[model samples]
Target: MNNLDLIVVGGGITGAGILREAVRNGFRTLLIEQKDFAWGTSSRSSKLVHGGLRYLKEGHFGLTRESVKERERLIREAPGLVEPLEFRLPVYERRKPGRWTMGLGLALYDLISWKWNHRYMPRNEFLQNVPQVDPRGLVGGFSFSDAQVDDARLVMRLIKDAEMNGGKALNYTRVNKLLRNSSGKIEGVVTEDVETGEIKPFHAPCVINATGVWAENLHPSPEKNKHIRPLRGSHLIFPWELIPITTTVSFFNAQDGRALFAIPWEGSVLVGTTDIDHGNSLTDEPRITQGEAEYLINSLNHTFPGLKLSLNQAVSSFAGVRPVVSEGNVSADKESRDHVIWKDKGLVTVTGGKLTTFRVLAYDTLKACLDMLPHCNLDAISEPVFESRRSITLSHTVSETVLRSLWGRYGKETLTLLNESDEQDLETIPGTRTLWAEIKYAAKYEKIRHLDDLLLRRVRIGLLLSKGGKDYVGRIRSLCENVLPWDNERWELELKTYFMLWDSCYSPDAFQNFSR
Candidate 1:
């Protein structure tokens, strides 16, 4: 640790990406997270790896182009995890953006990626594709391609890949203090294990703060009035049976004219993303407020009047605070999604970027650190973010879909997971795309520190199931009993803690109870 070339804080996508790139360049790097990996905004995103189509409307064509390029690269390199998703934006008779205007935007969007994947669908064809859409004022729609991913798994993939390439990562390890030299220059960090309360210090020539919303805590903005604006974006997950749609349906909310989406993710329909000032402490787990829930529900009802979606129909809800850097003059959605880097001698704080451009953020952050680590190679950014794809063959007959998923999430570790798993573990979870084996695999290998880590971020069953997968807790415990180091009493305590967390943070009913 004393000879480390770099240290990365935060364990989100940005931190993980930086660690991976640093390791690829043969730098001795270590990444430490205050909580579980992706315990913050990374796990709670809208689950899109999309080129910010709306950015084009805001005249941020450069951001859109970078995101589009990254989106295409991820689709090519990580197939199963970052799979292609079709999006359909239905046009209304009185909507602000008419057909011609939307067509122009889509044309530019396609031109950026050099892919002609967008087309104007007539009302009849649009209805045939999305019958659940409200047809009252429907004037056809625009179809385009984007991508989706298991957000937490993507973070885990980057971290695991980095570890495989000779980097180290620690979860639930908090950096209590930044160490500095005589000239008031940062030199290293003092870390404390959250669970054990054990304190230790590590030295590095260059340290990076990629803590997203918490970046300001480690390194404040040097500019006047420029600060990290914590904007909370919340989402509701419903069973696909309730609001079945093959492609994502993006529409504008009549109440505020803000664009929202109802996307098909995993085995459920994810409707989200109300952006507003958080106005809450960063330490507390974010949850959907009652007003935000109603706002999203109203948008869904307006778009799919036939479905009549409600909060009660939703299986779960989640909220993540965006680390948007703002000047306190613009609306929440009007803020830029671009990342910024501030260097204070040996410390480089990189914050405020979209998930789609993480690699770009990583390269930029490392380039900022080049002055401190003269041995680091900046050209390594051109290399692939992940290891080359390996051909995985199993003795048992597993579906191509499942194998692809395992490869995308686990990479080279897929064969080991399949080899070490019991045959029964190969079965998919009753209500999720997650395999039962994944629970065991994560418990044994994914550095899981708690039951919530296993269910919530690792496999996402907590977000996909009703009552936060309460019914399957027994089976989950059985699968992970030997793998996790929890005894009976510890198991009971974990269950109590996990259910309490789920009830307060992840349950859709939590909003109703909170409103009371």
Candidate 2:
């Protein structure tokens, strides 16, 4: 711990992946996050692990191929986190891309994946599989394979894996400035513990600035802002019954030619993701604009004419800014998803890229620094280790359904989660598949410094539940009362802070009559 070969700035998935890769490559590493891990775009993605079917249209074949390989690898290596999801892309009579065109794209997708599982479904079979789609102009659909994931959980698991491989992680630690040698080459960082007003210095031969949308803050350049554009993507969550569908429904927005999806996840349906340029400060939490919500709702209603969906039906919502590499004066959505890595003043800054290809991005980041860091050994890169315990364990009785969910999420730590729980903890939270044990385990082992860190990120009850988990606030408080060492006054304050964030950042009401 005293001497380090590399230091990672940011606790996001990108930083976590770098730390994991660095440790596996025999480097002594440390990772520091200004907030909690996955507290930014990593936690707020559309939660898909796919080959970017849309990217194929833009001639991003290499990106799509890499993503397909990684998506398949994650489904195999992290079975508990990355899960296969079926997608139905319904093509209407007047749709931009006709049925045949869409079918050809699906074929190419399947070909690149080499799994050959996609199919073109006729009207009858399509309606049978997805009864919710409007039959008005439905001209059949294309079914393809993809994957869904708990983005935040995957990031936390990577951090856990990095720690298991001898990498050090410190949450609630802010890197105020980069440290430099006499020649002004970056060497380390000066960090401040957010919990307390204490400053400390750490030294390392190399430092990585994997701060996503906030990357420019670490090593600012005259053209840094020109290189990276923050594109905001928002999603609205609804009760599964409201928009019941066993498979994801993909369609283009009638008003604009943007892609949108209604995905089934975590016992609920998530309809999301509008990509638009965000001109707001990176420090502020991204809130879904009312316009964005209305746009998604309109897309859903147009696709399922009978549904008559509205903003009121949305249980909650979320927004994240994607760090997209700018591609001239094009639209935000047209910006390249490919990540860029470069060294400036000895600081390796990594920005852009999709969530599904984080591992490749991490390896690329390290490879970018190989010349500058001759002492680092890339040959030592080892295969990921999946089974290992990082938390304490206890005894309990739980159902097989709940057991499998825990195993998929916790991996080797599922035993610890079960041991940490009793019968009461095994009960599922009302309206959610999540159990009370998840909240307890997160509070105990996930380094939850804030209430939202536990409810929103660690367990996602805040985003999945109606009213952002407000109804179960008392129950959750009771469950984590002993685990988190906070006084009654502190608990009240944390509750107030969490609710403010939930109402403003995780619900549609936050955008009612509000402007950016």
Candidate 3:
């Protein structure tokens, strides 16, 4: 038996962060993710590491402060991936929260977050005069800041950092069961490689389950461990030029407290997130039902008053499963977003958290795990999460915020794709929204063993565009032949698999579901 200090299950941001810290502290760390890193809800997030902008409205100020601090830290530390995002809230008639109320809400959001916070971005108030805000029903707009993150990129960087240290990380592998000793302490478990279907046994004293929605599979029932009510948040990407709001626009869903964003990603506008209750079955692809798409489209139209973001202009769509803690609320939207890390006899199961607070959650988990082990060092370090000078230099590499955006989230890890993409032409991958080198690099350093992993999680090629294209997938399939040793038959299968998953998860309406 190869005994170790810890084994982390789940390779989302939280698990990856803990893996990075554990290995840095010299713990013999092993992180096993059942699928590609961030393939679960982590990749499907609104892709922001914001201070709890909504939490402030709900008066969760403590959570906001911690999230704000972590957001800044991540932006500074991982320049290439996590970057500051400014959001403009356009006041419209009959919106749930009126302008005065929202103004108060945002002012409070800035008050706690701005405290001791370095000037990563200008304060929200300065952007009020910016003409980039849609001057439509946007009577008056209040601007605030959060973060825009390449959720998958950030997770990959963390995994790389962990590997850069001594931590061992295995993806596309599932943890079958938790090992137990005579005293019922967690001793690790059996794992199976997804590609080869080979099972292997490993041992560790502590096992952290960060498996997100799929976690219920690890235990007999999630109710037996902690409660996780799976909620699906779906997003729609539209052509960038249509209502190209330079800043993210947040509108209160008149139907519910759920919010929406018309924020820029890559070159398009991302409008999303309908919170609906989901279930036990977990799949890489979940289709967007007609009702959900209509709801989102209608909501955006209502917010912008006439952006014409109908199915005709829809480019792409994506969905995520949020494993929110079941707090006796019939509504998934009302479920608490706070996280809980509890020991179940021996297994340390982590549940219920958001993107903004992933770092603090990881730090707290490290402290608790180390305290459980007397000899392990959980010593706090004074190193700021990011280097300020490097952050500034990187952002200036492209435009007002390109390099800073890349370097902040990736740190030194940005070099992986930067070297490749820099040399290549700025061409979108055939059939997808991704640049060519990104997919090329994914095949290289990212260890994208399969196309589904590359298209969905590695490069977000298929998900970023408004119209999902079968033609583009075929083109990528041909390009991939230059890198992967797939036979023509296997190439077709990978191409079909990627589209099938997308279609299944987003609905089979062919026209509505196929392209955008």
Candidate 4:
């Protein structure tokens, strides 16, 4: 049995954030995840770190304000990882939210962040920027500032920071059940290793159930009438050349008038996200349905009629279940994105929030669990999310762009990763922003128990490249063989497993099979 001050029961952004905050506040924290880090909704997000501009139109001023503030903070703190992304919202004739309504909303969005970064672009100018957009209506558009991030990298960075501050984390570890004291209060947890099937007990007075969609399984919601509603948001990733827009294009779907986006990320154009109730079992990996895929494809064609994009052009598809607390009265899209914190004796459950406001969620969770932690410093909640380090000094051969990216992802470990890499390792993998050195570093140090964790989360080539980067398996294996302790038999098994998993969950063809 191991004793600790706090144990977080999830490895997504919310749980990672809690672990980092708790460790900084002088708590001996440990985070346990059933699967790979950010394998759930965190990694499958639309990859926007914005103020939820649509929320403002929905009258969620508080969420929009907090998200906007956090967006600015992340862009300032993590420059390369959370860079400013300009969004172009094309106006169409007889649209629900016309030009002035969007202009006022953008004005308020700018006002919340104290930056005047939005302007109305004429139709010709907008066409000059996004030539593929549908021009039948021939209306102008509004350009505004937001931010984007590597969702998995952000979660990994938070976990890495927590570990650096003496906190511990275990991936591929499942907390089977909560251990309770004689008085029926939560005391510890019984965890099972997903790979080895070894069960272990860890004692902690303060246990936080930041498990996102799976939170209710650990601790039921305090509100009997309200429950965690699993809403699926699916996305499609296409080759950049197919939908080559320099900036993010935000538009509304003509079929349902729902907000949709076409974002350029990591050398690919990401289009998605259909918001609908997820009816699949939570234990299985969420996949994009054929109906959802066709809906997204139709939206793309509606927005960019010139491109005439088809579903077959998408290289990959992914779906994630958002833990939305719902009263079961409104539609899935209308459900609130605000987080809820429930405390039952020693156990505190936190769920339902956006990726952009993870820090706020962390702070709020800590505040909720403050009474359980007597040694915690309240002031620590207001501290910077990341540690401020001295400027990195590296060889002149490393470009400023690569250095910034490495710093944002690895922080203090950037120098070590660079020092350990060969000259050729510094070059990025073809068709992706990830460097070959990242594979070696993650395999050796990032607790990669499986090949999917490396290709999917650590570097994200799995989603960026076709066939989940299957073509580069030989190169990746050569790069990581020395670092990873896998024999030939194990390597073959891992490759088979990874490719099977990718086909079932990530490939666009999966949707076709699923519909059949």
* Strongest candidate by TM-score: 1
Cα shift from native, residue 207, model 4 (Å): 0.6
Q: Can you tell me which runs of candidate 3 are displaced by over 4 Å? A: 93-95, 115-139, 220-226, 371-374, 386-410, 413-422, 426-434, 466-469, 473-479, 506-516
Ranking by TM-score: 1, 4, 2, 3
Highest lDDT scorer: 1
lDDT of 2 at 363: 93
Listed in order, each prediction's TM-score against the native is 0.98, 0.95, 0.86, 0.98
Give the alpha carbon lDDT tens digit for every residue of 1-516 in model 1.
658999999999999999998888888999999999999899999989988888888888888999999999999888888999999999989787899999999999999988999999999999999999988888999999999989999999999999998999999999989999999888899999998999999999889999999999998898878999999999999999998899999999997889899999889999989999999999888888888989989999988998877888999999999999998888888898999999998999999998999999999999899888857567787677566667767766798899888889999899888988889999988878899989998999999989899889999999999988999888999999888888999999999998888888888867665555
In order, the Cα lDDT scores of the candidates are: 0.91, 0.85, 0.70, 0.90
TM-score of 2: 0.95
Per-residue lDDT tens digits of candidate 4, residues 40-119? 89999999998888788678999988998899889888877899998888998887789888889889989988899999
Query: Candidate 3, which ten residues in sequence have the lowest lDDT sum?
Result: 117-126
In candidate 4, list every pair of residues with a backbone clash: none
Candidate 2 residue-wise lDDT, 312-407, digit = tens = 888999999999878568876667799888777678999899889989999999997776664657774446435532443447766656665677
Error of 3 at 415 (Å): 4.2
Off by over 4 Å in 1: 514-516
Q: What is candidate 3's lDDT per residue for 1-516, written digit by digit as tens? A: 265788899999889878887776778889998878887788888887788667675667787788887887877666556767877666654655777777777777777877532222223332453334334444465667788888887788778777876788888898987888888877779999988999998887778888877666775344554477888888887767776667777776667657777778877777787888865367535556677788888887766654555765777677788878775645666666888776675577776788777767787787778645536666534455544534322211344354444454445655555654544434555433455656666676676877778877877766655334555665566556677878979877877776666665643243354446
